[model samples]
Target chain A: MTRGSVVAAGTGLVLGLLALGPALAPGFTLAYDMVFVPHPVFDRETFGLAGMLPRHVPSDAVVTTLAQVAPADLVQKTILLAILVIACASAAALVPSERLTARLAGGVVYAWNPFVAERLLLGQWALLLGYAALPWVVRAAARGEPRRLVLALVPAAIGGFAAMAVSGLVVLVIGLHRPRPAGRSVGVGRSGVKRLPWSLGALLVMSLPWLVPSVARFSGVPADPAGVAAFAARADTPFGALGSLLLLGGGWNAETVPPGYGAAVTAVPWLCVVLLALVAYACRGRAAGTGGLGVAALAGLVLASLGAVMPGLLRWAIGLWPGFAVLRDGQQYVAPLAVVVAVGAGLVVDRVAGRRPELAALALLVPVALLPGLAWGAGGRLAAVRYPADWSRARAVVTAEPGDVLVLPWEAYRTYAWNGGRRVLDPLPRLLPGRVILNDAVRVGTGGRRDLRMAVEDPRARALDPLVRSGAPLTGALRARGVRYVAVDAPEEFAAWAGRLPGAERVVAGPDLVLYRIPGATRSRETPISQWPIAIAWFTTFAALVWSIRLPVGSLFALSSKEP
Target chain B: MRIAVAMLAGIVLALLTSFGVVRVITTSQQDPVVKPLYNYGTR
Candidate 1:
């Protein structure tokens, strides 16, 4: 590797260690959507055979496969650290400068910014993996080499459909700006064929693991329109919604903002940095070969701000086609803008060094200085914590029977006192051996106001909701639906919930968890959706990735033969 | 005149950045603690 490459990678590794802090320690870091168990079951749900939307489809499968080789805690740590290193290295490589300081400036800014901070705090590491893949994707697409593009897309493919969608958006925008040389007009033809070859088809094939299952069940599921309002971008700084987005700080969740991020004193300086980066990009971007990236960044910023600017339009679009619901979490599209800002920061340093070279050192330190909370695991908010002993007993008991397990409080997310009171998606589904069911309807809003956006994707969960709410004896109902075990993680609701299971046997009861075994609960006669299509889809994606790996190796072999 | 102006600008920039850094350190330590029965979709 070049000296610049080594420095950029080292910068990423250092920043990653700084950001992860105590999370890099022994235990699993359980935050929001991030859940890693000791042994994740590769069940029907892992392959999206269960009735709910397959949001975790191939990502869960990939982790489960990896956990087979290494401990899940180690796997999670490696993946999270790799995300930072790869993101910083790839973005630094994209700067059209040979100077090490210029590359360092780009890498530092890209890997350490508000967008990365908020996403990491929110525990959306899979999406962050795709964010890391983006600069590589742009580089590969600019070369118009199919193999390199496909190889660059491996991380997004493993990250599932949302990551693929975000990657596809930037690729589509960048593809639109490909130059037409010699007046041959390498743009869109009259016949409607894209001059930019292979990208669209490759994206589609890579997306099949999540796409096939989602499309198969698309008509059956209608996206909750309330989600548009719930997930719309909100300001995290003194700058209103649009201004916050331009600074890459308007993620929907207020709770996810870095410590002291919203205060005027801090926010003002961060805003200055953002404005300077934009000015630099506007002045020097085209000359530095970042014209296409600039356009993509602008397009991304516009999309990122759309929900905040026009929620009604977004709601209307989702109503027309549920597929448009992908646009609900607009803050995710700010990824390209983050890249633009980083490259712009690099340009600023490169230019300033021409005169007043000492000032370049300060510029190199500015991004980190402006946002110090991102260091040390977002102020120790993301420390690692082990699962409780009761949880393990509950998993073991449920797995011994190998029947369907239902999680109650009837809530999708839970907070264990042991896990530092942080809210995390229940690990029960992956921890146990069966089709573990939980509530899919997410509750939004704070304080007295509550909005339950009904996303009843799992048919079984939908069937049991009324029974669960009635607080009546559910022995007959559970038996009829073939729910062999009910895992209760709520301590407050323990007595009341356990009382409702009158005829069930208390298999394992603890303060943190209570598992009841319903005797005579036979497997439901309902036939499962055929797993053939999902399996075939996964196989094809894997096969294509394996085929794509050969191109680089073959090229190296050819080069060696010519040299001899 | 130009050197004095540059010095003044540098002092102000440094002061603001120092203030921002202090704020970031203070805020990073503060946890936006969620309630036991908190809304699943929010913080």
Candidate 2:
């Protein structure tokens, strides 16, 4: 890497750490599923990996292993910081410029944009990891070197399927740039066709871990209409959509917008668009790479406008396969566009700095000045908190009495005081381990729909709901299904239900959480599925990773042999 | 060959340095008593 790229990356890393500030002190942002709960990675029964694929498995495994050596919270924080650095470094590498100031400015914008800030607040670390690796994938594809291609897959493997998707898109864009041969008509498309095998092989190898499981257990569970709407891009006007994409600011949830944001914030996006246009005009035909990135940015914007522009089409495609739900949050498509804008802004900076060196400092300061709220956890939207001591004590109590525990007021998301007022996945299942049942309902939907009912159709979880609501006594029917302990976190909602547990002994009673032991509850029989697919996926991922490493090293040996 | 070696080495270095920096920063800082910005139940 050039010195300019190194400086840009270094500056971005320092700023990112500073931006996180006090949040990093906790070592964990207990905002969402990123709760500091450590567990074995391969528990298919508890995780329910039989019917679906979790793209975060590789990252989860890494964090789980890291927890053995360090505090899980610390490990989580480290991962977040690493992601930010990678994002900045990758963007810096993409800037085809010699100017240090311009490169630094680009890295800052790419790493600390509104899109990244919103996703971070939402606690989508896995997605962010994938987003961070995008520029590297683009860089590798542009070069089309075998060693570079292998290097690109490293991040794709670690980031999982989402990164693989982005990498695939980038590779396709690079392939489009393949020029026609000088004179031969037959060889016109031959080179591009020949390169197809390598490109496809790389994508398949990188995505094998997630792809194998998804294909093997292809549950065509369609997303709910409300979920699709809730996550859809909310840019009503054409200019508004373009501005939002440029600013990286089109999150569906209004709450995700910085607390004190006003009209001034809207101007920032427009300014970014204007700057990018001016840069494109100035550098027209001068930079071939910029043209490809511009095309990518335009494509990303169109994809992001899917539901917003044509709701019926988006919904229709989603109905064809549940996998299309990945596009539900079309706003995430802004990631590549953000990279393009960052690089364009850097080129603009480079041009201006060449004429007036004094203006370089001003260019570097533009990103910070424009998006100040994003710097400090999007105005506390991404604040970190330490889980209460009682949570750990409750986990121990549940662990001592070994049986399947059912969390009361059973819901997927919970707002915990311990998690800094952030709504997060109920940590009980991960904390206590062993078939801990919780409601996995998709409540965000219109009145009645089959697709929306998929997650909520858990008979076991659904059976407990009415019984708890009626404050009915726990009978043998409920006990046989393996709900041994009733863990109630929100007492106000379920106190009456807890009062109805017949012959139940209070294990760990606290203000925030209470655990009740069922007297006659027994362990439910578990039917284990064939583990061959999981084994194959894991084995293939490991082998591919090893082979990727060897490919580059082995090339050096080949070079030496040729020299001798 | 040298460029390829440097690229690989740089990746490893970046990964290690990031890990080390985060660990050191988080561990060295005093743990702050963070209060919930708003009531958790209201959300």
Off by over 4 Å in 2: A38-42, A45-55, A176-191, A220-223, A235-242, A260-262, A265-270, A273-292, A442-475, A551-564, B1-43
Candidate 1 residue runs with Cα over 4 Å from true position? A180-197, A287-291, A356-358, A551-564, B1-32, B36-38, B41-43
Candidate 1, fnat value? 0.28
Interface RMSD of 1: 6.2
Best by TM-score: 1
- Candidate 1 docks with a DockQ of 0.18
Q: Write model 1 residue lDDT over A376-422, tens digit each, in one string.
A: 77777788998888889988777667788888888777777777777
Assess every candidate by TM-score: 0.90, 0.81
* Reference-based lDDT, residue A154, model 1: 85
Clashing pairs in 1: A259-B27
Highest lDDT, which number? Answer: 1
lDDT of each residue in A361-463, candidate 2, tens digit only: 4555555544455544544445667556666787787667678787876566676655555666677766775666777653332223322322443445656
